[model samples]
Target chain A: MSAAPEATWVPRRYRVDAVRPELNDTVSLELAPAAGEAPAFEPGQFNMLYAFGIGEAAISLSGDPADRARLVHTVRAVGPVSRALAGLAVGASVGVRGPFGAGWPMSAARGRDLVLIAGGLGLAPLRPALLRVLADRAHYGRVAVLAGMRTPREVLFRAPLATWQGRTDLEVEVTVDRGDADWSGHVGVVTHLIPQLELDPRKATAFVCGPEVMMRHTAERLLTVGLEPTQLFVSMERNMKCAIGLCGHCQFGSAFVCKDGPVLRFDRIARALAVREL
Target chain B: MPERDAAEARLIEAPALQALIDALTARGYAVRGPRRRGDAIVFDEVARLEDMPRDCTTTQSPGRYRLADAPGAGYFGFSPGADSFKRWLHPPQQTEFRFRREGAAFVPIESAPAGVPRQAFLGIRACEIAAIGVLDRVFLEGPYPDPGYQHHRDGSFLVAVNCASPGRSCFCTSTGTGPRVERGFDLALTELHDSRHRFVVEVGSDRGAELVAQLPGRPAPAAAIAAARAVSARCAAAMPERFDRERVARRLRETPEHPRWAAIAERCLGCANCTTVCPTCFCTTMVDRTDLAGTTATRERHWDSCFTLGFSHLHGGSVRASTAARYRQWITHKLSAWLDQFGMLGCVGCGRCVTWCPAGIDLAAEAAAIGDEPGAPSGSDAHAP
Candidate 1:
């Protein structure tokens, strides 16, 4: 076989200049283009971050959409690249490729009540969509944020949660799977919180992001509450290597999660989601 | 339009065949033909026509295959190898992207190589040619074409061989892909023997006819054509019992909770041997490797199987954590749901999975087992039937 073309070698890179620890294991890094303009990305789209020799990983963008100067990624240290990312200090260099995969359809939620459900590190991607809606509150109706963490230590954006709780325009509820002595809030799965909210199912749109099991259970709960399957959206996570469609690692059914979606309507993936293994 | 040619093509003797192969190489095409490798017959780069295996045969049973010595000179031997045309088209590993670091600033790097070499693959089985067609629908004609795959595929040539001997596990007839060449080849050959070994080569393209005319060979007799047909018919009759692919695809879409998945999953190691050997498995993963100077980072793309636990990892955990889930994902995707997306069957009935599997798991048997049983509702039936 002969050598492939040189056009295949170009790497898309963004720079991480600042790091902020949000929760116990979660750290948010602010990224800016090393040169030229920062790549404009959607709310739920993620980038593949390479920590030099350590490796590469798919990380969701966590900052607000209006912020063009920097890109923020909230990550938990679980694997090699994530661990290497957590170890980096401010001004440390990291390689980035793509603002890949489909993001949350904010326009689809216009003039509708928004229900945001997230668990553990899944809350990272939803944070941007939540903030984007809040920035222009008149475009949407009542906003409900339901977040669940494994423990009190894992709860992210504590400062923002307090602010959201203080606001009469937004309804924020927090839950933990296993709480410590200082915990003084709801203790149950994220799906359980769906019963507490009172909204017109027809007029509301929901966004869910978490483990596949958690997302499935959450979507089932929303359906029971009279929400149409089309009204419910979920963010899917897969082993995305390229963040582009070329590397077929992140395929969910026929769709490439890195290309078609990380965020998709529940009804769109209903048949595939019903498959036991996938 | 020109009337479809129905007359059988002429045959040429074995010694005269050397001149044809030489003519092909003289035109600067890298020719790959069958050769004995250990106990198997594999397709590899051949310098001359003499490199083709003369007297070798293969024994194939459900989940088993072995090469044995034959009585006479036979260019075609055994069954398909573990590697398929995928090794040449998609490749096992390739660089997708590269990056350069200039002091504190990391800049995007551009340095992809070049196009694939012009080559001709000789002695390709009819099933493999069909497999290539299946992949072409996926990587080329799909909504988004694969640039890397297109570059290699467009540069290569095909020379298909009719199956003179079918393996015990072979079921290309059931998959509607083989026993004889119908399409997807520049030239096709059928070997015959009456008094001496001769080959009946049919030109499928203008390029093939032009090349054949350049070779020093005589036209075949009517008796030679009859002998070639007899050999191909004998091979076709040897096809193994296969599952109803159309019915299986329908059932898999409806019966998501089939008990057969659990049974096969018990034997599956999630080793990815089946997908790796399969000609049409197109899943891949990416990697980034930096030079010692830390000045450049190369992003590499490598074949990845859905059988791995990490394939479905999310924020909190993986969706399909069990070996059972991974196995189910692979089988259901290949046989059933693939048709809905690609408008073509994913498998070519090559039987690579059956023979190459360490556990001796047969896909046809598994499909038949689950498909025959009445599927239960809900995901509670998590064990094998």
Candidate 2:
């Protein structure tokens, strides 16, 4: 007899090994497959995380690509499905169907000066790429990480940021839109930090992730700083149901953000992004 | 090729159509054909030849559809209604998967009983046939194919019909998708409504030839062949080609900020009736439902439209929040971006969107207005975001 057909939408069970609250609304989950080891994923690939009786949401793999034992996702309590996923306790179960979409251009950026820019919760998708790059620190030249937050209180991965900041090999700069009493870092948008970086602009490759407006501004700023459009990448977010490209929810013009990207070269989508509401 | 020769240009009287239906039923196929449903003709199960609608045609225009009696015995006289083959194949709502909670882990449970009966679609129009081909490119040829769609489509048989009566909203001639069945069908029929009630059958597959062999028919005379060609030629004459595909696609790609979008949005209700009636609009959303005990949950995929506010929702809010933006996305995707994603154009010029739209918004007219000219920088007011 013929084998039963596979249902691509059905997700495998993953036990929540750990859950770390990043902020008032955001939480990071470490999930291990219920049966075997978690499937390996690339730096920028994402998973459709199902919250038990709740629906699924596309969350990027925020953990290290080198580690295959568990899949990490940082989710914010913004929508109904995300809220339920954020509140999951350790030992709870979540459905996962994933490792979908194109990954960051690590091979292309090899031996090139690396720059990473992120805004607000967009840092979650970029965290895995950073981790991969840091693991192989000798792969490239000068490296800089610029992050922007709404406020100091909303900064995610504080411990990791502090650890990376102390390293002499890396440059980590963070800014917030509003400063508080205890804050002493820059008090402006992330684009302001782009010009301050001292590097060979012609030799550097940058990856940006943030809100749409922030990404647009960051792309424009990087271009003005002598970085070519081909040397820059951006992670896009859209409403996704089936991350396999069957559902047309995450369409960004001709490209399906779930498949053709979550990580796309700036030059590939520059014209599409310029069109408002596309 | 032998089967093609055996069944090519066979002329069968109107009453002989029952033999084909009987042969399909004998092979455990559920024959679905058009029948009068209220004021419209819809595809429904027909156990006999008489069950299909006859001597009736539809009056279709922008935002209007009316069923009227035509002076003929043609069974496939009416143009398509709001209902398309999508309603049966993709379905408005379908169960994707079911899960049972076992302690801290959710285990996959068996879905509904399998063995979807083989379906034979009869009285399908040329435009509808092209729409099915478009869907095949989306669901079957993608990197990750949908099992549910494949299960429903695998054993299906299609019988295409040439439209002798073109409605006012019909423009298949423009898209080059219809008025006559070309390639993609198991069997094609051209109803000869002149002087006598007969059909010119062209077999497209082995199964179609086998079914035709069981029927009582004669080799089509020269007049029958000429008559069949005339049916399509007359349809093309009735409806002039609306817009040049390459020109409109290029124009749409260049002008996303056209002012015509905002003007069209003023009349568009964003009701999504156009997409609902569309044969190839294949956007869907997943809905999860659980029992009161919470032990089991079933996930269902429901038909969704790009026009819905929630279709483009993100964490903070929707991307295309304004109706104008949604309208631009839908039409631009259909006319231009679809070629970039899939090799073929998304629209087959079925014109159901024009007829079913509550606001009488004609997609062809809007596309021409926005896409016939060079790109203009329509200031900030034109940008919906």
Candidate 3:
């Protein structure tokens, strides 16, 4: 097979300036413009990050969009690429491609109560959107964030969580799949925390991300609590090779996850969701 | 009714035809013609006309094809090769975008680089021409035309040869494509042998007419036309039995929950060899490579297959996690759903799926098995024989 020429290639790059360990195997890297200006990307858009010789993986920007001086990507080590990404030190070189894919509809949720549900590392992408909503508190109604981690030790953004917990405008609840000896917070699945919240589901737009099973069950739970399918958005994950529509790898029925969304309404992909293997 | 003053052309002697290829190359066209490669005759750029396989023929079955030396010097030696017409159109990989870091911001860059040269493809069979039509409907006529594909297609010329020897795997006649060239070529050549050997050339395009005018030959007589028709008919007669694609599409669309899918899944490995060999399969993936400075990134488009496990992973889990589901998705999409989307049958009945399949899976048999059933026709086996 003849190699495709370079002119048609999409350039997706950002520069990494700092790295901080968050939890076991997970670290947060701060990025800035390596040379030119960083491409303006939406809150939910992800970038294809290349780890020198380790290969590429899609990572969502974890920092606020307005904070263009630096972009943050929080990643959990899983594959070779992610492992290499975790090992990079401060000022190490990491290639960035996109802030690709659709992000949370923050503008539409301005006056609506915001319910952010994140499971494990799924919290990484939702953090930026949550911060955006929290920053502009008067535009929205009740704001609640229900974050689920594997354990207390695995919880990410601990420092930010501390500050958000002190605020009266945001109701932050943390849960774990299982608990350790020192754990004192909610020790059940994240879904368990949803019932205790005193918010009107009709006025709420929930942004749920994390494990596929968790998101499905969470979306189901949100429906039971009266959130409309349209009012609920979920960040989807797939082996997204191209952030463009050309690659058929990330297709969910007729939609390309990399293009149409990494974030989609529950109603949009319900049928594909029900299928056993896709 | 034929136009009175329509330009007419006749075939040159075999030696003279070789000379024409040499002359064309001397004028700067990259000449890609049929030549013996390994076990098959494939199209490749050649420096001289002598590279054309002059004495080769292929035996084709519903799911098998093998090239062999012909009884004598037969110019139209074999059926189409394993490579599809899409190879020249939608190349396996392309760059859709590029980026360079200027200071701290990444800038989006897009351009179409020129490398593929203008060339003439010789001995393109009628079935191959039909395959090109299917691809044109996909890439060129789509809402977004592939710039790279359009560039190569516009630059290339075609010389279609009427099939005088049908392979066992060929069912082009049933697909309404060939045994003869009705359209979609610059020049259509029909090999004729009587007192002497020559190719009766019919110019289908203005380019073909101009080229024919330059050849050292005369307009063919009425007898030569009859011989060409007879040869085409003989090839058509040898086509393997084909299926009704319309009926197959209808049957498949009517029955999405069919038992045949599970049965086929039992045998399918989900390797996606069929799609890879298919002339019109156009799925791709993108990847980004950043420079050492991490300031610039180059995103690349690569060919991807649907059979892989990770193709349909969402936040919760994979939608099509089972081998059976993937196989069903591929078949249903190709025969039934594709018709709804593209307004044409996805398969051209080339039988490459049957011949190239590692497990020797026969698409015709599978389609027949499903289409024969009454439970809403689960798997539409509509294929042109």
Candidate 4:
């Protein structure tokens, strides 16, 4: 909350420069600040996107962190707020309040092999981290990107997935719960790909982002294979009214998912994540 | 009364009390104090000492609250009611900002031109004062501190009142937050029910000392100071049994799957009365309103409770769908998780939650039941100090 009204609850104006449809219900919006250059954001950090007459939804930055001209957010229209945001025209106005919450341990994962997993639209948040890692390919060791979707149609970043799969430095695995006739990928949960990944558990760090249950199962598998809880991180989501943590909507135990995390060490939240409906 | 020297205390009679209110009113502060409204003691504007509730105290228990007559008790006889100073500071519904759509962009409409008026809260109980401190950490000390809260907090003055009459449901004694005013007030008053109907005023700030100097008050005698301490001691002694704060917090964190929650949920109505009456429960939801043409919009933040299914709603559905889970979230967050969030328990032991619960749910009793369960790990290494 700065002295300026725009910094508080009043959001800064952002114009939609581009809109790329991912799925029937999901789209990626590239927003350039209505005024100065866009603010820099870290991978896994999110913004509270406000629609004109509707409300705000917490959407993660899905663009490359190094990109400074525009902010990109991938929104899946599951509620009124997200629907209003996702259906906006390219030239329409939107409200943005972020670069909030703790980001993925990019610096912590440096010099260590990485295991990045996503489930459903969960790929949207992980996109920035994946892009960051790919940009610095030589700075890290073996990189594994495993994705799980309900169906082949829900697969996001199809073009980038293809580009990453063509690279020899990265391991990209896509799995769908139910595959179509044209689908050539594995059909199972994302946790199934964990056992097949070829990396030393001690030297590797993992970042898992998905629905609650999926993150839990992925964490369990990662731990069983000897990836210490500190070596694995998960991004959590809840109803976030005040993304700055004043509104208690996003509190999961002591951690206000908006501030203390969106990305949290597995060990810190392992006990809380197991508690049903917390 | 909680932390003050006898030499610094002042004994003020009814005339001096009225003079203090008048002086604050002259200073452009909206002096708010407890007054009897309907069947409850609620806060309202106080123009004089008589405007406050007199010879009144409250009888409170689980699911019940009633105004009772205390023969010799003075204006500050009652324990805190459902409404707290939070209703004045962080109002239930406050307009965050208004916006008007002009072509493709939305422009923010300026709110009221004038700033919020300074406020002087009179008769704030010790627990309620502690609750304000908790809210300060919440809205003032966060990474992105709320400007509205900061403005209200900075412009406000606190006048704490030491508790001489402890309600049946009150547990400030157990929480170690009350029975006497401590460090957070400008002026603290302890009503002496002994011989004369007077107040023992303890000046806490320069403003308090200035006001006391102006008012007609004599230096408090040793007997008067002793009486104030005796009042607090008697109040604490009369309250319910005390439970170890660390033990209760640890039990709640360790036993997320405890059967006690389900049992409590069966009786819990999910009405959210407890949170509504709670002073430190600061969760809120944004209500966005727009005209029929959808050209203008206003976003208002309203008090929201964890009991509501919508409070935890996500894309698919609500995260905490069951009554059991919502209750668990509220209790765990208040008692255990708050320590991890703000380094103090969210509850001030004001007991509004217990007295106002429609289901007659006593959280202290429930916490004790869980803490007393066999094999529940016991340690002082919990989140609380």
Candidate 5:
């Protein structure tokens, strides 16, 4: 493939305007386009963030889509590329490839009660949808946010969560999977928080992002609570090499997690997800 | 004389094959045909017909391959090698782009999907042609067409050969891909070496007609057409229908926890050799490299296999950790999921995997094992190869 004839694979340069260290090994990077208009994207959409001398990883857009000047991505240093991306300094140049994949259902969920659930770093992708929902608050009914952190110290977007908690218009609940001596909050898996939620389950649109097993379990729990399987939406993650869907690394059976969805209705992917190792 | 509108056969002596090579070369086309590389037949650059394998025939079975000298036989008498057109069109390692540090930002400069060879691929088999067609559907017909695949594919020419002899592991007849090509060729030929060594040439595209018109040949009489059809028909009958692909795909898709997967796990090494050698497999993994000074970095795409543990890695670890699950994913994707994605079977019935597998794992047998009862003589032990 030495033949460099196409621009699809070439990453556009984006400067790191700001960096905020979050919970252990995670950082939120705020990027501004070094050239051209900032790419337009929706909630739950992601881009292939390329670190020079490393490689590329699919990172979701955590910043407000309305904010055209800045692009934000919250990343955890799990892999080599992610590690390099997390360690990048402000003003450092990074290659950015896309604003690809399906986003959360904002227009579709209008007039319906919404449940936004996140576990650990899964909050990054859902942050956009949360912003969109808050903006169009009058269009929807009760917005319930149930976020689960590994511990109180592991909570991402601490200031935003605290701000969300102050708003009486929405119900924001935070739990921890693990706790420290200073921690005095609910301690359990995210699924445990679902049963305690009191919403119009019949009209609620559930958006979940977390470990696949966690989503699977939470969806089952949501189903038990009266939300239709089709009403539940999931933001799925897989080993993606090409965010455009050609690489075949992000295939979830017939659906390409890169293109067909990073955001998909739970019913469509339930069967494929259950097939172990698929 | 009969109306010769493309399918009309033009006879060329086996020794005069060099004329065909010269014909392509004259048109600024690099002639890449099958030849001997070590012990296997591989596609390589050919200046003359002498470079093609003539006095050599190959034997292929599960986990075994042998090429012996067979004096005075026709050339191109073997199944495909590990390398398919993917090696040339997609490439193993390609520079996606070169990046240079521009102050605070890194600039990814252009250099991809360019310099694609303007090539005439000679001796492409019927199955290989179908594999190319399938790849076209994936790289071109998909939502985001791969620029690298489009540039190389659109510029290349194909010279397909109908298989006069089917290999031991071949099941093309079963898959309906074929011993005879009906589409996607510039020039299609059926080699006949019975009483006299000759090629029954059928001009396919406008380009094929031009090449044939330049050659010395008489209008092929009815007898020549009948003989050519007979050769392809014989080959079709020789290759057995190893699997019911229509039913197998559906069955494999429905049944995920079949005991057959656990059984095959005993023999499967997850070496990913099958995927690498497959004609239709097109997965790619990318890597980035920086120079010693770390000033410039280049993103490179490499041929990736699903068998790698890292291929399925997420935050904690890989989604597919077990060998049985990985094997199931490979076969199920090839047979069933591919149908759901591309509306076609991923396998073109090439037997390269069976011949190259280190543990003698035949896919046909695995196909039979799956979608069958728990124990009903799957033919996995029959040694169809």
Candidate 6:
């Protein structure tokens, strides 16, 4: 029998329940599934958020993974589709395609000290993994989140960072590359904060997401700090057109970022990472 | 030729190929076959046997393709051309879905599935059939199968023609894909025009068996079957063996920073013609379009090439900043890394890349240069200390 493939690109309608401004250009859309329950997705996974006539962007699920009714995406207005998504009105309806790609390696980090590093909006995708770890605080050994923003204003989910910082057990380190007068924290690149991290190097598993340059730098520094390449994972951002890995935009050598990974082990992409234009 | 195959292989006159087209039409299929178009032979609709490029064959060299009229040539004389089942299957530009802005969000207008029309692809070469197999794995076997590709590929009928005149650039014999088709066809045809214009048909499946019964032809003589086999064997011998298929992936992945890459990239215009004509190069990008009032919109998945700078662009910039890098990525992916992604080699040895390349940049020459270059690092088990 000829098995005709069903359409995988069609997006299901979802209502933007609320559009809370996270930063000047970033908006956190609390989405509710129009029909049944929102698609159950793992932390570090992403959904293709479509801005109706605008386009689609691969936005990571930032809210609690346990919340089945709502899909939270912290979108930073970068490109055309992202700008449209960021400017989306509250109660506006949009299209959602996924819950695609491998989320952060949360299970692997169990019982190991977790080092979460974010550069710019790279923090958005990692937010879910951090929330997942915070919910089950007893499972993980030690949790440290290193975030770097362009300015203090660009720091996402500041309220939670403040709350988490008050806790002595969990280390929340936030830095700005070039902070203004209002900033009273460490001022440097994200990798600079890596040296200050006091976690046991052998047991520490770092999750880095940001610009390719930043990811490369963070991964290199983590390696120097006794984290093997395998122990370090990074969420890559590419021109992902088809979330299913068919469109070929997100191809990084053999790995299709949409399917095999948006999150991949640092060792796996090392050769390709060094290979320019791959 | 051995024991006169049980399926009743027939010796149908070359003209009788039209009857097959008629039958496919009667069964409600838009029959498409190779026909001459200016300096090239292309696949399009065919109603009569005369519509086929019987007397014309293509002469393809590196960076050149021209059709020439040759008297006393076989019915289907040319190697596979720039077209394949991809035109109808994984099309260049296809409107995936049409949506209208309804109040809050856009609602999809349930139109017929794109390119799922009942159609029959006639005169598909063995290599082309192999290409369809590659595309099938990519779009069908994956977890999220491409609906448009699957819709066209699954329902469509394939009638492949065995290669009797492979191009000068052809190397299907080495790739082990063609010279003759092994699978993925309803019917396989070998044009035997040695004595007189005729075709020896082998029924590939139940559908082919039924069609052969209705076409009014006697059982193929043992001599004609031998002639058909000889035709493909001749074509196979004509093709030059270039790349080492088994060791290609390993060699390419090892020599990423090879100096030969810069040499080839020197003449490479990065025009992307090779990728456009490549049947197996299935990289594509989506284009989102909106109406004047922004009430309606359509998303189109158009063919894209890896050589293009935009193909690898990420958040801030593209990974491939240099032409040398782009060329390296294309050849390495095509020859080597594809084996890791898809079990089969991505290069079908079609030679379309060689013929269509503006710089006459032969993949074989480039690959050989890397293999033979002095001081080139032999192995880079990257990440393996």
Residue range B196-247, candidate 5, lDDT tens digits: 8888888777788888777766666677778889989999989988888887
Instruction: Point out where model 1 deviates above 4 Å.
Output: A1-10, A135-137, A150-153, A163-169, A176-188, A245-248, A251-255, A268-277, B1-10, B95-116, B141-148, B217-234, B269-271, B286-299, B307-321, B379-385
- Write out the backbone clash pairs for model 4: none
Error of 3 at A109 (Å): 4.4
> Given the true complex, what DockQ would model 4 score?
0.55
**Which residue runs of candidate 2 sit more than 4 Å off their true CA positions?**
A1-7, B1-7, B378-382
Q: TM-score of the A chain in candidate 3?
A: 0.94
Worst 10 residues of 3 chain A by lDDT: A1-10
Global CA lDDT of candidate 5, please? 0.84
DockQ of each: 0.33, 0.59, 0.17, 0.55, 0.48, 0.49
**Taking chain A of candidate 2, what TM-score results?**
0.97
| lDDT at A70, model 5 | 85
Give the whole-model CA lDDT for all candidates, comma-separated: 0.78, 0.87, 0.73, 0.87, 0.84, 0.82
Task: Give the docking tier of candidate 2.
Answer: medium
- The docking category that best describes candidate 4 is medium
Residue A58 displacement in candidate 3 (angstroms): 1.3
**Candidate 5: which docking quality band?**
acceptable
Q: In angstroms, what RMSD does candidate 3 have relative to the true structure?
A: 6.2
Q: Write the per-residue lDDT of candidate 2 for residues B98-189, one digit (tens) a residue.
A: 88888877788875557778999988999999999999889888888777778778788998889986889888887889888878888889
| Candidate 5 accuracy as TM-score | 0.94
RMSD (Cα, Å) of model 5: 4.2
Q: Lowest lDDT 10-mer window, candidate 2 chain B?
A: B376-385
Over B180-252, each residue of candidate 4 has an lDDT whose tens digit, in order, gives: 8878888989888677778898888878777777778899999998898888888888886657789989888
Better of 3 and 4 by lDDT: 4
True contacts kept of 5: 0.68
Reference-based TM-score of each model:
0.88, 0.97, 0.79, 0.96, 0.94, 0.94
- Model 2: per-residue Cα lDDT over A1-278, one tens digit each: 12134448788888899999999999999998888788888888899999888899999889988988999999999888999999999999999988899988988998999999999888888888888888998998888999999999999899999999999999999999999999999999999999999657889999999898899999999998899999999999899999989889999978999999999999988877877777
Candidate 2 chain A: minimum summed lDDT over ten consecutive residues — where? A1-10
Point to the candidate with the largest DockQ.
2
